[model samples]
Target: MAGRSCRNSIPVAFLVAVLFVLNPPTGVKSDSSDHRYKTNEDVPLYANKVGPFHNPSETYRYFDLPFCSPAHVKEKKEALGEVLNGDRLVVAPYNLEFLSNKDSEIVCQKKLSKEEVAQFRNAVAKDYYFQMYYDDLPLWGFLGKVDKEGKADPSEYKYYLFKHLHFEIAYNKDRVIEINARTDSNALVDITEDKEVDVDFMYSVKWKETDIPFEKRMDKFQSSSLPHHLEIHWFSIINSCVTVLLLTGFLATILMRVLKNDFVKYAHDEEAADDQEESGWKYIHGDVFRYPKYKSLLAASLGSGSQLFTLTIFIFILALVGVFYPYNRGALFTALVVVYALTSGIAGYTAASFYCQLEGTNWVRNLLLTGGLFCGPLLLTFCFLNTVAIAYSATAALPFGTIVVIFLIWALVTSPLLVLGGIAGKNSKAEFQAPCRTTKYPREIPPLPWYRGTLPQMAMAGFLPFSAIYIELYYIFASVWGHRIYTIYSILFIVFIILIIVTAFITVALTYFQLAAEDHEWWWRSFLCGGSTGLFIYGYCLYYYYARSDMSGFMQTSFFFGYMACVCYGFFLMLGTVGFRAALFFVRHIYRSIKCE
Candidate 1:
């Protein structure tokens, strides 16, 4: 045992070092800390990606449109996380001096050809918005506006491009605190013509001094729409708390009153019990401990669930501790991907141990299944989505080098750790222990009523848990799918706990009822019962897609459903494991107290 412990510590220590090196204190802000500047230091402005307002994920390079570029056309080298978030920051033509104001100055004169005009017209029709960064402060402006008023026919609709920009830069001491870009409707040019057009792009800069510190500058960008978000978040938290309390009440009632009575009744000798009644879960002691069929899959699912649950808690803790913030683009994704890969050992160890307990001998196959169970489907989905993004020429498509690096990380680091954990699990295995001995032959399950059937029980088991978190789900969906930023990790963590508790309680109740119905097949049923919450969540996703969101088009639709499917599938695994373990403990306790033979 000491040798095994020592061996495990080595890899764990290495993992910690690797994590520290990979994720430093560096935040989503630009690497440049040259905030303190003289009166006339040249501050370069970089333009980012542009995308349709409705489809946030489907973005293209800013220069993809017929926009004027700098004479040098220099691109800023972005971090891996930034690139993953589809940020393409390139130096723009507009040059500004610190604390210096400029009047309406012509940025560049451009003669747009027929193709360029068509591209601009298309961009305007889609309501594309552009983003730019000056001194690490982001600014946004629309490419054009659609005038729907005074137009009877759809074909007669007018598109007007905003040719001029007004920039406001706020400074405190020597630091740039805030920056904003605004377009005037008066300076709009009619882009309804498809022929060549000569346009002069113009911009004005106004500098203002303030007492606001540089550290607090990002707070303004946090949430402009906070009151509504706070109200909904509080409501959801209260709703989840009430649901958890009710579930706990049910558990307490069952454990204290009902189970206590059953324990006393069953404690009597067999003859005395037979004289009164021999019904309920106590009758199925012999078959309840029987190894479930397809136990390999169950083990793998449990292992994956364990990994996901830990990953979630760890990330939330990191978020709470300020490792990442809402403004940090791709930081969360980068952490999730890295942590999941590093924690492959946990999944392997868990799967191997459970499989061993079930008397499984195909260790190699079990290891492979444990490794690929979740990653296989996720990889396939990502690949398909990436292909679609590439075809659409969207910035969401990962570069070939990035893809190769990710693959290498998984292949080199994740795989070896999985094998090591599997080896340790196999070596430290113990025989399965059950309070009640299983009979050689399985017991026949009696006919159950409609309400007591597995499907109905599963439906009942899932609904309560889903109801607990459905409100929170809306906010989560909005933040991910829409433009809302999710900064409420504390609330999310609480709701997550409530969800696990609700799932465990509901699943255990169902398992108890199933056993009482003389159905000893509680293993897979308990898992599926808890996991059914994911089904309810997926159903809600359908409702949210149609009712709640304005998200349209093939790319956005596919991205939403595909990624949401993966998330819901993860919920299924994590909650299913919680249910299975809870039910197993409940069954063991009750059987042990009753003196199962």
Candidate 2:
């Protein structure tokens, strides 16, 4: 405990010094601090060149996905109007292993296949069936083949039906090809028997020249236009605001249940010790000081929140650092996966230590739970989602070998750190103490009028704040990971900072108001303070579905992924803010109780 106290003192002192220097308390600047497109009233449909795709003099490169089938290549290329001859034309590659959106792959290199023509043909046709999951059917799947130049599995070959070749047609240009077998279709679901596959080879039917269209684009999340992003960001921001307020008030009601029974007076047998204690906050210092009733729950939440916050910050920083090079497309996730694996030490250490001390559960259970609760879920999500992508010939999918290596690293490196951190955290001192206080007996205070205890006023306080911003948030998540176009990340960065700050402050203020009003259940109220951000985000998504976005046939599975991601992000941010403030409140109350002034 002495060591823990020492560690905390240095950090607390450092934080206070930093806060004094920066004056961070008031709040961050509003959303407009960095928006390129000003005002929700006017949203421009398009912008001039800023990045690589808009740049001329670009080269067509080969995709390097392993296990690409030669047959699919021939069929796809012929559909692109390749005139078999000495004439050479740019074509996407068969194996698109490690290419980015900016770098196109060469998919038409000739190759041999030993697998039976019929069996292989059927497998190719039924690739979707090759991969399946509970309640999660794949939209599409394909059996890919790599070059077998130096191989013993030889087989009879069939001559090319037509000279195969294809080129990635960018969307902003006019159609330059005709009379080709276009197999392109953005089918979100598999085997929509009633609905015909509308095949079109033109730009509208494809994703960034690569076969794996939905890999890195945030569009799958937002509208492809700046106006759309702005619109949705605001919507989601508002939704979250409302959620924050509602939750803040809700939690207040729950916590105030303590007030319902005159908790300070009735619940304490420690009253006999009150005389030995100092004067201030003496009534219920021991038990009511931090409300130990939910320490287990609180610790779990803080663990998850810290993990998510760290992960998000890392991703944003990586983006700022240009890790997602134009030439390096789907590799963003690869980088993130590595960073995440490496950072498991932080997650494990933080969660294990915090949980062990707070929950007082077995240290081993605490450590394992901390590791698995976070890193484990991420790993599983990656595997399942990437498996689906691989089946659909989305070369961005992570390979089995990579997954295996990641797990090995996790076991070797992270598990140990988590165990140690748990031990250290368990031994740590509580950051704040409930002020020393004692009372001979409890005091009963009668409930105030209904208005004083009503949940309505606190709930209303969040509406304006929430209304102000859900649209903005909706577009950001959509734009970032939904495979949508987002050039104005600078603007997005501004809006994101503003939204979070506003959410935190507004929620806190609402909680304070309810407490003053004598409705003291602050737990859920604290959670809802930030939780409202989701409401605005989801609302913005709804608006896009109606007003801005035109992605009609996105599969149910995609919807599920999108929604789930939103919930996880929303809750994590909300709880982090709540936990931080509550910890602060605990400290303040403790000190006040001790002074008894």
Candidate 3:
């Protein structure tokens, strides 16, 4: 009985080992005081409160600030924040005009006409907000009473204002644009009832005598803004590497041994010219490549999967090269949108080609399905979340004009690319090379044991893939949902490679088991087995929301889950593609090696 208990415990012990390797606990203490906000001693005190200081070296270019117009304005317009409804309204390009001169000071005050004041009132009524960038950090301006500890009280929140706009331009050797702002009694404007508000602007310039290079100052600003987690990131990567190496060694050894034995047996049988054959995967070669029943859906999945695969690879490569560094607000989102739009051609070509090979006739329908499959769900979710954000007066909500721009990008740019790719794919010949000819009727799959069934196999296959990334996922969640700054793209790239390998190996292992059980219908099973990792990831998100995060608002919750759904969908596509390709290669290699004429 003791020996029997020991044997039963072996599987549990192995599972615990894998879990430990995947999530090695960091030695750092989890004390709340460690992360509490600390007052920077270097910051200058104003009225017993410390205010943010300007880093002269870092300069940033300003973009258009989004404003919602009242029912009077025929169309909404986006403009520079400095020009909108500030104490000192200034126009674009000229807003930073001070940067052109090295040692000059000028003060100009402009009075707004009745029409302009009325427009400003209308903008305030419609909840106009400013988007300000200094260096790479986003600056948010709010009007409220400040407490003794330098904290603004939410109860005293009155209105939104862009108080002080200071531009510092240096021309020692090269031109640079630097900006910093401070709030004072004179800069505050109360717009609670949306009445006609007059605006007057005064400019004061001060030059600091310093010899620091602009690049060095910019580097200093970046370092201060973003969090530094190099040690923790390396620790997580080492753990993940160990897990991946173990999995790789185990898979390589098992596959080689099994394949070698099978090859030897088959070769010996061929030499003896035996009529009878083995009773495993060799018997199912004729039906292994049989087209699945839902060919169109399968084709669409493969196409979208391939498109996401390409997008993820390119985005990571760009990030590794520092293209989407945190210094640029919204740069990553812009890059993803542009890349996804351009890669629509790849999606179209893949879907059309696969559908054609499946004997599909409607090229137009296939093309539409391929493009809409992933984008449709994403757009719908985004629209729903945007609505919630707008209702809550959240700055994260996108304006209608921006939505139109996104629509135009999808329709004008992405649609044309998809059409071009579909035309090319439809005109090309469909060549599917199968060693054994498919039978007229589908092969009957045998009854699988409960442990080997679809759900169980998917659960087992998904756990390892999810485990490989759950540690990194925690950091990502903190970055997205908390105040953490994530800048470990190199480690992310490494973990991504590991995720692909683990998914591929596990899918191959699961496929082998299914085939050995005389179950040849693996088209969807292979995809789902590995793709289920996304389901696990979604579950973890739920856990984080309830257990780890302090989020409580309805809008925040809705937006979080809404965007997470889209994330999981992309993960499903990517991992599903990896699993399908791996299984396909496994099946083809196994059948091609056997003499099944």
Candidate 4:
């Protein structure tokens, strides 16, 4: 045992030593961009794989997609994201570097199928926008070898973003135009070698009909780089790790303190939680579950939205970590639907297994309904929309067939596990055996009544943070599905992680505040806590469309429609996530109270 442990330590120590010696990952000295988001400095593999191709269609694997934020002067981007409705919003940051292929053939070899080619051409002809599906565009999207995170081996072939455009002199500048193309003084460099430039250079074209010959032909040589936000870097990882560890530690401490407190357990006693048990819900005998009966449906919906908000964060985080990766294009929304669909077992099993010590329940229908209602609609909806995109030749079709394949996998893979979990959750007697126990007799849960219940309180909790972010959301959906050259993917990625943490904290704090104000029945309102943030996003999108953007053409109008589609979908997603989470809280509240063991 000692020898084996020593052997393991040797490898660990060796690895750490190597990392330290590297100091930086690559040999390239830090440039302006590398200072913020570091890039590996070694030359990537130069050759493209050729001949005897088995799975040619594998070139479009969703998992293999690469994206980066467009390069800007940095200052300009911060201003864009910080303005307008930002109270409840969490924004994504941008990335701003690009690399080139050693041999252009690597990208060229990534051939598209007949159908895809047809789709692209037809979509363009029909005035339909073919959004870049997954990572690459139909033709130009496959710029080079990919260089996403966790796959940085120097020798292996990887897709790279073309940082520089080689200006091919169609009419020879030296002979035809009577100027030197390569020289700094006279003409634009017509070279075969690709050089780095910012993506902004495309829009920031500084040419004129009448400029001096010295400057006109080859004046400014600012690096023309493109954006790729698919990868996360060392600094981001380090920053996130440090912050997440500290936050997690602090929250864990608070949870422990709350759990250990005698008053808290007593406050959660039985009758106080379960005065109105419906028999159908009895498998969860000690468990309590109730919606906040607000004065109106809108108010109740707000509380439900809070639930959706928190859950959305969870789903997005999972997607961000490459859990689903390129395998599914609609990973965020897809994950949401699936998680909500199977919550009944989790909720019921949690309540029944814990409150009555019954993890195995006879009420499979209840669990199915809980999870099914949420999951079924989303799958069907996406399937429908995906079909439309295909018909219209929209590149945004997002590997719809692939999505169906993955969904089927999830159903086959996850359904049984959920069912099994529910069975065990219902049958378990662990709660009774556990040394920890809840206090007996129901304490009067300070009567807010349904109208005065926790729903209103929950809706308010997440509203402000959501407001802070709505502006940011509008730009994102616009850029992704919209044809605008999205250049700030790195910033967007960082902002995404930050938003999740910020939103969750804001929601939790608000929910706690409402409860402390003697609103004991906060079941549905909890979801409202995080969910109400989306409304702020919707408002900002409208504002941007009206004020900031120049939507004069058909493309602009179409983009507007696409943006609206995303927002509406996003709204329902938020609403569903909030509802699901509140349902969990309600179940937890009741389970803790109803326990007699």
What's model 2's overall lDDT? 0.40
Tens-place lDDT digits, model 4, residues 364-448: 5544543444345555655665555455433334453445655674577446645665467566657433222323433344444
| Tens-place lDDT digits, model 1, residues 1-597 | 999989966854564444445533433344355567778887767888899988988999988898887656678876666777888778877877889898889988888898898898899999899988887777789999989898899799998888999899999988888888999789977888888888989999999999998778877756723787778788878977876787779777876687777777777656474466567888888899999999899989998999898788767766676656655656666777788888888888989988999999998899999989999999999999999999999999999988997899899988998898888878876777799888899978897788887688879988988888888888778777877777878888888888888888888777876887788999999999988999899999999999988778899889989988998999889889999999989888788887765
522-590: candidate 2 lDDT, tens digit per residue = 554565555545544555556655565433322324433454554555444444444345534743543
The lDDT of each candidate is: 0.83, 0.40, 0.62, 0.36
Q: Which structure among the candidates has the greatest lDDT?
A: 1
Please write out the lDDT profile of model 3 over residues 100-125, one tens digit for every residue. Answer: 32222223333444454444443433
Q: Rank the candidates by TM-score, best first.
A: 1, 3, 2, 4
lDDT at 79 for candidate 3? 25
- Tell me the lDDT of model 2 at 176: 14
lDDT (C-alpha) at residue 193 in model 1: 81
- Relative to the unseen true structure, what is the Cα RMSD of model 3? 14.4
Candidate 2 lDDT for residue 22: 28
The total number of steric clashes, by the backbone 3 Å criterion, in model 2 comes to 93
Clashes of each: 0, 93, 0, 77
Output the lDDT of residue 178, model 2.
12
Deviation in Å, model 2, residue 381 alpha carbon: 5.2
**Residue 73 displacement in candidate 4 (angstroms):** 43
In lDDT terms, how accurate is model 4?
0.36
